[model samples]
Target: MNTAAFSSLPLNPALLENIASLGYTHLTPIQAETLPPILEGKDVIAQAKTGSGKTAAFGIGVLSRLEFNRFNVQALVICPTRELADQVCKEIRRLARFTQNVKVLSLCGGVPFGPQLGSLEHGVHIVVGTPGRLQEHLRKRSLRLNHLKVLVLDEADRMLDMGFEEAISDVISYAPTHRQTLLFSATYADPIREISKKFQFKPITVSIDSSHHDSVIGQHFYQVDKARRMSALGYLLAYHRPESTVVFCNTKRECQDIASTLDNCGFSVQALHGDLEQKHRDQVLVRFANKSCSVLVATDVAARGLDIKELQAVINYELPWDPEIYVHRIGRTGRAGKLGLALSLCTEAELPRVKAIEDYQGVAAKWDEVAPFPMAYAERFQPPMVTLWIDGGRKNKLRPGDILGALTGDAGLAGSAIGKIDIFDDHAYVAVSQDSVDEALAWLKRGKIKGRSFMVRKSQWG
Candidate 1:
């Protein structure tokens, strides 16, 4: 089941080693079925849910076609969101870990264009990005598509659902005429099939978990009054006190309201919706994924490619119109060899939707009563100990170790005194204990990391 097993599938020894280093001994169903055709240079259409190992499925094939010495963009993976682009690029980088000079760039909107243009100018071998920004780069001549060998449209249906058809088609039209077109999605409706027909040439199709069966997740039903659903959610959180949880609402506004209510109740919580600035959305996700925030309230679209490893539970604050969304939401948990809990707060009016989910799963949910939420019966908002902002990150060759060394060395602060450190593409965020905020700031102002100075400032969480 190791990379050695896949060695006969026409991959190099270095790639095999890289796969081993990534702790992937054997391929998942998606990888096993899709890798061979892709490695044989055939176009593939793969359907798999999140965390089903599709990233590595296509990543290996893309990396196998690359020549380390060449700097041209050989493979272009277009993801629907910036977060997804970043995630895909990270996976590609890992698959190409042993190879020297494998430069993977993620181009997305809301990030600084200047840096991306500069990176493109320097040269890149693989590019992963969102449709709009990729098209923008192509128009500006910053991203050339002539050398493209493989074109991957990840989350293809989501792109169509999000109305990225024009942007995706535009980017595709610019790519070379004879390139491999690979499309990956959770479901392949007529729209995706039509796009495949238009763009892909007799591609091989691989479907895993087509029924969207979710067995690992423990389903629980919480019956509450229409007005007291929020109270029931609060009670469940206090009762279970899961390490991390995502509460899904039917609308963006409901997500905001729930997050605000939780924050007011003294919980480390954040809301992810379409209305927030991209930067804030990124920060909210980082906080929730890193356990800096205990709860994340989000709409389905905003929560779509979120892969939190230790996610303990999922709460259906509002029932989705499509019962399939119920399966996708709960599937986020009960992953990576851990048990997951899926709870739904249902009112009398939503009985049909609730029944649909239960019938689909072929299992009945255990009903529960209104238990006491030993939760924070607290009053109002309290300011955090200290907010951190780092103006330098991966592009600047900055890392957590360097930041830690700088803070402890130049700032003369104890390691335990630092609260949290969240690193992004061009910036990082660190939190210092309230007691040492003044000293940390005063010292960092004069200190340097890797002999280079960066702008460090307090964060505005509100």
Candidate 2:
């Protein structure tokens, strides 16, 4: 039997069928290495990058050992960010499709606390959340881990980087000491090893190479005068004009400044930083993910846990101090068998950082010169899609299919004119092609979704 096949694992028949239905025939390297130990109920620490099927490996393990009959929290997944927590919850729910009653809930900050308390009151089988929020719930006695058989620290390094080490320890204090603990991180740094020593029992360690290949990601370094950095960025944007781009800034202030400058330069752009309210962060992420925004300026911490598919480019406005961070930033693009572009702007002071990166990757830096491009070229930089915000969502029983049906039916828009449709608890965002924005918006405002009226309007940033 091929060990790479999902069927080779000792999974429940229903789960095997669901995995096949979901089109996962073979295991990713990370999954193949980690799942066996995970399913065997052993403590494991795995090093793997994002988009590497790490979630499925852990999700399947959690589900396989789940006690659906008992409503208590049997498994806990701690993430660094709310976006990541929500994403993990969704993926686990999809994996749990084999059993509809396997309850999973997200407990993250930046949202209402009352709802989380209410969900806890009702009970859940699995809880995926940020460390801070989970610690809070544990403190309030609203959440208990006495029944937790499995505990997973997803992106453990990122959680530690976000200063959640103390909080993570606090949450762990409440869990059963003998339970299985799984730690997954992109980089196995010294701190990660320390945490593993402190928290995990004797564990199996699995590592997958996290390096990006030159053939997949084309990297270019441009030397610029310290004062001319913004112009160089504008030149790069105008010269390449990728459909979707993420500009990585080293600081929150720089992230906001670059986003404001790009927006002022007539580029559809948004900034993601720690300072923004959660609602604004959601809007920015939605616009960028739905292709309603062309450029996203974000700090590394702010951009953590962002899973954007088909990202065309990643630009480092300023080089990070660590080569590992550089590798992580550029790794966001050039995924899924598509060519990825990584452009970096460097000054005389930043050459050492570039050298650090070169030594880390074992490849010489590819240098390029930046020249001013015609400002008129920016006219073509407008995003191809426009997003419409609907004030009704899961709370109102509104779904993506309802919104899509309304637009394509009464709105008379072609299916191709519709883009990504995202539904939240109390609101939703639908992306329509720029040419069909007016038509979609008009129909959404005049017509009804699921036979009920909704407050619909064009997103301000769209």
Best by lDDT: 2
Worst 10 residues of 2 by lDDT: 372-381
**lDDT tens readout by residue for model 1, 333-401:** 888767789889888888888889778767665777877564464633232345677789887988888
| C-alpha lDDT score of every prediction, in listed order | 0.82, 0.91
User: Clashes in model 2: which pairs?
Assistant: none
- Candidate closest to the true structure, highest TM-score: 2
Each candidate structure's TM-score, on Cα atoms with residue i matched to residue i, is 0.88, 0.97
Off by over 4 Å in 2: 1-3, 374-378
Colliding residue pairs in candidate 1: 2-25
Query: C-alpha displacement of 375 in model 2, angstroms?
Result: 5.5
Clash count, predicted structure 2: 0
